[model samples]
Target: MTFVTSEPYIGHMGLGGIGDSKGLLESELRKRHIKWVDNARVTSVDQDKVNVEQLDEKGRVANTHELPFAYSMLIPPFAGVDAVQGIEGLVNPGGFILIDKHQRNPKWPNILAAGVCVAIPPSRPPRCLPAHRRPD
Candidate 1:
């Protein structure tokens, strides 16, 4: 089996609390004979298939191909409350509020956020790790 990741190392989402020792986990994955494709990303998806782009050493797309599957599902990314869209620097590119450890917007100190209001990107397989995920 193969697992692909855009990161040079796995565990950025800290799955199973393994982010701190990503290299070790990667070694274990290799010992199990699983092919780990790093620096690769999914470009598109459709029922029965996914389109992937393999990046070059410099992280530019070097090649693209299909990865076929029998199942698929999808969940969209979270966004900030409609009240905050297009406002100046209040949110990230994904439209979710940016927060500090206290969950307060640094610029708008009065503002606070958590859960869906803040974007915590999913760990793997992309798009919240749906058992079967399709592209938006």
Candidate 2:
């Protein structure tokens, strides 16, 4: 099996990862003989192949890979509801509600955002990879 992700490295899990997650997940994938492509962007998907662009640290395509798979699963990118979108200072570009430490919107203090609608910035910036954007 092959794993493809936009994460700068393994186990980033979009939260800059937990402790040792990189090492642990890498070890496990190695043990299982599973391959992974990091900083990957899926350009297209066909019946038997997934076209992926392997991006370099500069956010440029370093290589293009045609990965063949008998079965594939894709987890679409996340986004906040339409109601919160386009509200400047209230949400990020992807529309996820921007919240303070207390889960309150900074610009709209009276409004509270919870659950998946809340935006959690990565603990650290990705080397050069762009933030995950919802598909158009």
Candidate 3:
């Protein structure tokens, strides 16, 4: 079975368009007799199966089930870096810990950064920009 996370923006694109696209995709899969599931979240996965939790109208977990598949692909939610404290000159004002151009922290050279923690400087800027505006 295939699973898809429903994004809220899909509604703005028109429900009929979304439903028709889904219907076409489903029809193609149905021709191959492949089952599918939507609006279900994967809670955990093991070597042989994945545990899924079904959500209700209020976004509460209503039920759980295990599904076995020969192949699977998962796309997780995005989030910022972890909070860092007790370190001087190591974190940016925006809560993403600071790093140099090489992705190494200035204060802690051994530390490297990825994800949202890596800061990108603005292309156009005043010489004396505020601390909040600078990429650091």
Per-model RMSD to reference: 9.9, 5.4, 12.2
Residues 1-136 of candidate 2: C-alpha lDDT, one tens digit per residue: 9999988889998788889999999999999999999988999999999999998888889999999989999998767888879899999998999999999999999999899888898777665645673222
Q: Which wins on lDDT, candidate 1 or candidate 2?
A: 2
TM-score of 2: 0.86
Best by lDDT: 2
What lDDT does candidate 1 reach at residue 14?
Answer: 23
Q: List the residue pairs that clash in candidate 2.
A: none
Error in Å for residue 129 of model 2: 8.4
What digit string (tens of lDDT, one per residue) describes model 3 on residues 9-74? 222121224445656766777887766544567878999898887666456776777888788888
lDDT for 68 in candidate 1 is 74
What TM-score fits each model? Answer: 0.55, 0.86, 0.43
| Model 3 score (lDDT) | 0.60
Order of candidate numbers by TM-score, starting with the best: 2, 1, 3
1-136: candidate 1 lDDT, tens digit per residue: 5676765556544222344567777788889997766667788888778788887755678887687777644444334678778666678765788888788888898988898777554444343334545344
Give one clash count per candidate, in the order shown.
3, 0, 0
* Candidate 1 residue spans exceeding 4 A from truth: 14-19, 44-49, 63-85, 115-136
Question: Between prediction 2 and prediction 3, which has the larger TM-score?
Answer: 2
